[model samples]
Target: MSLSTKSPKTSPIKIMQNRIYELLKQGKRIDGRAPHEVRPVSISTSVIEKADGSAMVSMGGTKILTGIKVETGTPYSDRPNEGVFTVNAELLPLASASFEPGPPDERAVELARIVDRCIRESRAIDLEKLVITEGEKVYMLYIDIYVLDYDGNYFDPAVLSAVAALATCKIPRYEMRNGKLERVEGESMKTPIRTIPVSVMIGVIQDRLLVDPSPMEERALDTSVILGYDSDSNIVSIQKNTPGLLSLNMMEQIIELGSKKAEELRSILVEAVGLGS
Candidate 1:
């Protein structure tokens, strides 16, 4: 008697995902990088000529552009002494097949809010210096982030671009003319910055961690965490995306790795801002 056996067929998506996860378990990756290594990142300032300040950061296949447009605006009643800072993130359809044409969904909103808080809470820029007429009007810093690709890990690069853009940005110098703000011709000044906050994201699947996972790896991961570190080596912001329960040990491990990455990224930001690497 003869017996016939057949192997079950697997979908390409499932096979691809399995291949990625299998490599993770073996301390290997599709790109042949170290388990905790990040993709090569390059940054340049002033990509958008019309924007007062702009920067583009490319990490592997992922790319994000941040543009800053500072203008005179009214201060909020609750914080009349502070200038308004806003971050808007756009996941354009052209960037990826998943991003649709419509209002920003929860993902977009969350991305913007996280980056906004990082800059605001970290005191990256001295908002008080933006005041022109005190409670009447102040220079509002509007940061718009454009996602040009969706390989993975957009948050860290977006925040980096925003900071770089702001650091190199030029705001029009205005003086009170007839008790009204008047722009001074042929004069512009750099944004008053206090510190640069570096944000880093890590992908975790079980006890395994990847510093900057590719899109496929990110999709297969169970959890991810974002950490924002200030110049003082203090944690400024933390955002977690967990699909399953993460233990305290896992959180600490993530923190320890993230802190080191933050310091490295901050030096890159400082150099990009013309301070030094």
Candidate 2:
């Protein structure tokens, strides 16, 4: 008797994955973009008049808005001379069906932390300058990020929005009166900006790499890497999502691509804020 030698059937998901891999082999993406091409980006600032500072960023289908609120608070014990800065992110249910209405989930927390690291590590803001009084009272900046739309990549746009909002932020002046911190009426000043930080995300599938992967590509990706670069082209922060091992050559490629893409994104932010490039 002859034994059956039929191979297992291929699932639709596998077929789609194969298609993506094949396209990437030709340096093309399903979205008709080159391997190193980022989606179209649009940025606007001062969207919210009530907020101290606000910015909205749209990258492809992804949309993110960031607002800044300045208040007086005691400095941290470890860094009494430096002001306090915090980042919070909210992934609204309207942004995506997968998101649920409740407290911040892991994804939201991760998004906030990544953006925070990018800014904090890059030293984009001069925290020392925000101090109102040494070891007593200082300016506390609250950066709130809202994900209004979900495409694939939220990190890049969220960072961009936060940076833009900060770049155009106006901190209300305060003074010490009767040993109390009093807000100076009709007085405000811009935040002391030291440098701008831009992040680039690269998705990897098999041996292929894609820049700014869309929602569909994100699902097909095996892993992804996000690198944040400062104005000096120095890598300030790096985060790798999902579980996958990258070869040495792929790491080198990602670093090179990330630096180039970061510069492009930084120029857009600078222009939006009227900062000379």
Candidate 3:
């Protein structure tokens, strides 16, 4: 039941790991993907009617769902003019056997925080427009991420879902009525966005650099990286998981590899977000 402990299921993964390592040595992957090739990407928007916005993304075997909810609340004292954004991730037990039925464990929390850093720090949303009243009322974005299928590399897929949900989110109209903020019927605006950020994660095992590694492959990797980029190819955020020494040259290579992959993924999002629901 302990989320932090490695599951006994890992024993089966060990065999897979050895198989993948052998394949990597031959410049290939078990699934017949190139070392830097990512799996197929597909997305669907407005998946939930109750939420303001929702999106589902599937990357090969991994499936993730994200919902966007805008709430009216007081703004932070220091950031009176800006809205607030919180990202919450849930590892549903149905998604995998290792997941438990309780509060999010460390894995879930870390996934949420990393996705939050990628979106929030990238300044993807125009938070100022979310403010209804100075220091009094502001619209806050609640991003709920559900891991329906965690095959591998939750970081990148989580980011994809969040961005898609946000891009398709409708900003509801609210006003100060009777000294309280109330929603205005039949008045909704598009979510104000400043930039689009895309994230790419790759696992490094020995001399192999693999994009979108499978769960088995991740278990055998020496290290991994999750990096975010804006439309202009600027690095927005970066997270290096586990403790391992990486050469500067290797890091640079990974950055270049990640940046290219992010651009490819961005196009998919752009097309999906442009659709009319």
Candidate number with greatest TM-score: 2
CA-only RMSD, every prediction: 6.3, 6.6, 3.2
lDDT of 3 at 238: 89
Off by over 4 Å in 2: 1-12
The order of the candidates by lDDT, greatest first, is: 2, 3, 1
Instruction: Report, for every candidate in turn, its global Cα lDDT versus the true structure.
Output: 0.82, 0.89, 0.86
List runs of model 3 lying over 4 Å from the truth.
Answer: 1-18, 275-277
Model 3 scores a TM of 0.93
| Clash number for candidate 2 | 0
TM-score of each candidate? Answer: 0.91, 0.94, 0.93
Note the residue pairs that clash in candidate 2. none
Local lDDT at 228 for model 3: 92
Clashing pairs in 3: none
Task: Show the lowest summed lDDT stretch of 10 residues, model 2.
Answer: 1-10
lDDT of 3: 0.86
What is candidate 2's lDDT per residue for 1-277, written digit by digit as tens? 1011111321226666788889999988887999889999999999999999999999998999999999999999999999999999999988877677999999899999999999999999999999999999999999999999888799999999999999999999999999987989999999899999999999988777888987767767888999999999999999997676766678888898899999999999999998764
